[model samples]
Target: MTLALVTDDMTTGVLKTTDGERKSRTKLYWKRRREALSAVALERLADLGIEFPVVAGTMTIPEVCDYFSISRSTLTNIARQYYEELIEAGYMPGSVTQPTRYSELALAHVAMILRPSTSDQAMIIQKALGIYRAPRGAVKVHNQSGAHVKVCGRVLDEAYKLVSEIREDDPEEVWKALEKRNRHELQVLTVALAALVPNDRGGLRAWLAEIGLGIHSDAQNKAAVGLASLVPSRQQVSE
Candidate 1:
């Protein structure tokens, strides 16, 4: 019985059976790609001594715009996208009783979202925030009996603590926070290999073959070729 692993491209899907064994590397490839990208971004942040701000109390629209150097429209757009999140984080919204003002934490989050970084690093920050700072049970999982279960708020407790405790003068602590959040995507050696020979399909295939993750079909080879583009080049940067 062939198990059809669901992916955007069925032919190049994950966990498909090939030659009497389960072998597909799409997930691994993306995981490594994320790690490599995150590492580079994290190093840059450390070098720049970029400290995520800890502005306390609430701030009105003009104050936020001035401090962050962002447009009012940009803040409105991001606030709308994270409206529910802002409320849950104790940031007050404009109402009959009170004016809308954002918590310092909310402002910090907005800065994180807007920080200049590569796509993968952005994704990592978003996911980490969702998992650690989001409202209770942001993610759900299926149990052994296929019953949907809410993940505990404390699931990423360590990473959450690390992020919350990052110090201004301690760049190493900043690195640790991001690295902790990116724990699941950790695959340093694999990412190093991908970087060393990004264009060498034959070499990649050989290396993967030795490790039992080789492209086993024409469809997968095509998929692998396309996936190679996901690996960031030396010059990949935000516009």
Candidate 2:
């Protein structure tokens, strides 16, 4: 009687493990189709918010098998089931394959949800993956030959300092406080402009003369009308 009971226990154990064994083989069946997954399909996975490389589309079988941890011949047999669809999706690229992407219908048919690619998708993915870069310095300088333009940063700080000595926003008020002979705002603007380019006095004089600034052009800082060498090219970048 004891021998009979041991035989029954062995039979029960095999029955219980059979389901898990079949499931393992099923997973392996799908995993071996290496050529099935394509770059575009991977992008599609990102779009779909699918976890990892796993996807259900005709072209996504390799990914699905991978997710299931299936390998070897079992993966090959499962892959054969979607073999035709994979070829149609251009996964099996050959001589005549003109490099095509998977179709929407095919992608949707398989279980992968296809999401639209947005302009911010790249940033979103980076954020999702916890990737970031440190911010850069804010100071910017633009050179247009001798017309050196220091944008924002130090320029704004200096402008505000000069302006605070007189009025906040009104150039006329600033001039009045300084007691200039000519109340013209342009004259004041030119003087204020001079402060920006302490390094390029010649360029300042040339620019001032053209606008009838009437400020004596320093013989020591002469600049040609056709030449403004201190100014930076628009294409050049400085931080």
Candidate 3:
């Protein structure tokens, strides 16, 4: 065997570094290559209908490879090399043992660009937006107002009490006494209260609306027109 083939200059089996270097072995300057797809590679991915978003809970890297007829190693190389750009492009991280999922935006873009069926396209967009269909029979709502309605017993009892208490034959005296207490302000308040039907019983308001005499009875609203008419109009006062 030749002497050069068997020997290292340092005698430690490594060639000594030159130019006043301290190392007995030569240093390696790593050649860094950006881990991004070239234009051709990107075009290929697009042609394969692969989108770029990292939709959560969607397919894994292996699944993606399967769908696109690609190998895992190729995808892994892209990920390992161009991780930053991938993230900026909305790639997401994988959890536990799963591979990364594409984002909603990515899924939707792929679906759109691939010209899938209308329903499938909608589904893809929904998936990308993280929207899910409500499961059948998840919600059952009942109309409570239509059921179990009895005439208000308390209101009836109160009315009975009011009737029993009003034994006086002269209601004018009572009316005068009430008006004197608040000087007609009480009448205004009572009118306002009467105009507003707070109970959702669909009784008075519903009936009025059905009869073409809704609470907003006229163009200015029935309540305003009616209330205003109760006071003499400007034309009437001028006359």
Candidate 4:
């Protein structure tokens, strides 16, 4: 009878593990997995000059996956398991009920758990988060030659008008919209402009100067003028 019972248990493939034991093992696995993924993701961010701790934007699930190059299922698992802690860290905490939203600081905390204090990457990111402050003056300096003029008056007003016509969206949104223009469109525009202008080299050079595309050197200007002579004028094409 005992032999028959052992065979039945073997056939059923049942193991004698308590719920607590299973929970503990699963929690341990999650911890190790989170640490490994965080190490890889943080390294990539560091290489890209982005420290996660100080990054300001909140990210949706898709954005996070794209930014970190992590699989959606893995992120779902991590976020689900740590939902409460994420909520404490300012995440909305409805991953199971609604879309999961994550902030940079929350992601930093996820890495901090079970991660060694001696990790240089982690230390650097944390240090920047803790002590870094925005500068009061200009963060970037541009080198200007004698030809460059500061934007003001009518020039500034025209620039503002141009920007509003291009995009009334936020700066990043405007950049994203501009990024949709491919190289082919630029080539087509260049060819069309070159064709429309009259075939006179001096006239082409003058037009180029007016449009702020004046060739820097006499040699380059000569080359541009020569190329213009080769392209048929709009009147020539009509004939």
Candidate 5:
């Protein structure tokens, strides 16, 4: 009696004899190659901070094969063996429905490892708080219209609250926020704010300078300076 094993290769399915004869040699060869590929993928996933079963959750068998340029059989075998280890180790959630959804814990771990530094955090806080102030005379114009613009009450309140809580508790949170800002916005804001406030500790002064400079220069250094000096200074007064 001949025993047959049925297998699929996505595009096609085939049957092979279980006995070590004829087509069995080719099947075994393919199997070995598949297993090697799976091992490579498993090692890469571990290095990338993907929690075992959870990382498996983030990709389908085919996706793993495609991402690592491996065969489906190897991917399936690796996932089946190590996925349980991942779950047992609490790297993956207890109940996972799909292979494409990793646990939040895994994502958090990756983010913590990838988070930025403190000075970057401070620059971000400064830029966010600094961009809401009014021009020296613009407030009078605004007051004439009965429109009182509250910088803290409006723009910076939420950001400030978040930053204060984080500065003492999780300094990394501050760096994350700063890293999210556009580089151009950050550079322009930094340069303009530096020129205006000169003193870094005062929030109100920093905000006003940032806004005044931002509007005058559209955060452009050349435009900011030109707009800043648009009004003739006392030094430029002629007798």
Candidate 6:
């Protein structure tokens, strides 16, 4: 009687294991069906050539993958295969190291891929171009109490325009023209013009001249004297 019971228990366990396998197979089938649908959607998007977008004024490979929820390997393969197809026909810039570093050629490539409107393309190009730098400096004045005061800030945009105009002409010519102006007049003009020009030693000199101040001639002379003094002292050492 005990042996008969043991055999019955073994048969029941085997039946349960068979049922579990059937359920697992059904789940796998549904999972595969969903993956197939997702793959179809991705392919449809690829057919429409909707992979790339402008990022930081450049077209990047990773940005496209992230936007589409696609694997890197799959995207890379797709890019390699359809790269010329997209370029020759679709007008996309393909991919680069970073979107921010997109060159003019790259922008042209993107234009083909995206088929942007002429105006839209122009805007994108504008955004990608380098921005102009603004000028900045410190202002100093002596108060009635004989205290020296200084204020530092960016020059006004209008002042920058004047500086830009001045740069278009010769620097020495601009200085010689301003030489006859009084200190107060020079100060106002120099500060206004400096705001527009690129920062450099020449620009600094131009700025000083605009303000009725010349380059530190006394400092240069003093340095020359000091060097001459050192030469005699050095000769004494050698003797």
Tens digits of per-residue lDDT for model 2, 1-239: 01112245446522234555676774554333322443354465466584343133333444433433333233344235665655554443324544223343333222221111211233343333333222255222223444344433444565567646433345445444445444544454545666456542345455434533333444433344222232333454242
Worst 10 residues of 6 by lDDT: 126-135
Q: What is the lDDT of residue 87 in candidate 4?
A: 68
Q: What TM-score goes with each of the models?
A: 0.29, 0.18, 0.22, 0.27, 0.17, 0.18
- Once fitted onto the true fold, the runs of candidate 3 whose alpha carbons sit more than 4 angstroms away are 1-57, 104-239
- Candidate 3 lDDT, tens digit per residue, 161-233? 4334433334444344444556344543354444343432445433323334433443634444534433455
CA lDDT for candidate 5: 0.40
Cα-lDDT of candidate 1? 0.48
lDDT of 6 at 162: 41
Residue-wise C-alpha lDDT for candidate 5, range 115-185, written one tens digit per residue: 12312322232233222122244312113132334532333444445435543544445545656878754
**What value of lDDT does candidate 3 attain over all alpha carbons?**
0.42
Best by the lDDT measure: 4
lDDT of every model, 2 decimals: 0.48, 0.39, 0.42, 0.50, 0.40, 0.41
When 2 and 4 are scored with lDDT, the better candidate is 4
Scanning candidate 3 in windows of ten residues, the lowest lDDT window is: 26-35
lDDT of 6 by residue, 1-239 (tens): 01112235446522233445676775566434433443243344345453335554444556544543444554454445446533433324433542323322333333322312222432343233211112245232313342221222232443555456554665556555556678965675566565444442354443334433332344544435433332344445467
Candidate with the larger TM-score of 3 and 5: 3
Which residue runs does candidate 1 get wrong by more than 4 Å? 1-56, 117-239
Candidate 2 Cα misplacement greater than 4 A, ranges: 1-14, 17-81, 87-97, 110-239
Question: Against the true structure, candidate 4 has what lDDT?
Answer: 0.50
TM-score of candidate 6 versus the correct structure, residues matched by position: 0.18
Write down the RMSD of candidate 2 (Cα, Å): 29.0
In model 4, which residue pairs have backbone atoms overlapping below 3 Å?
none
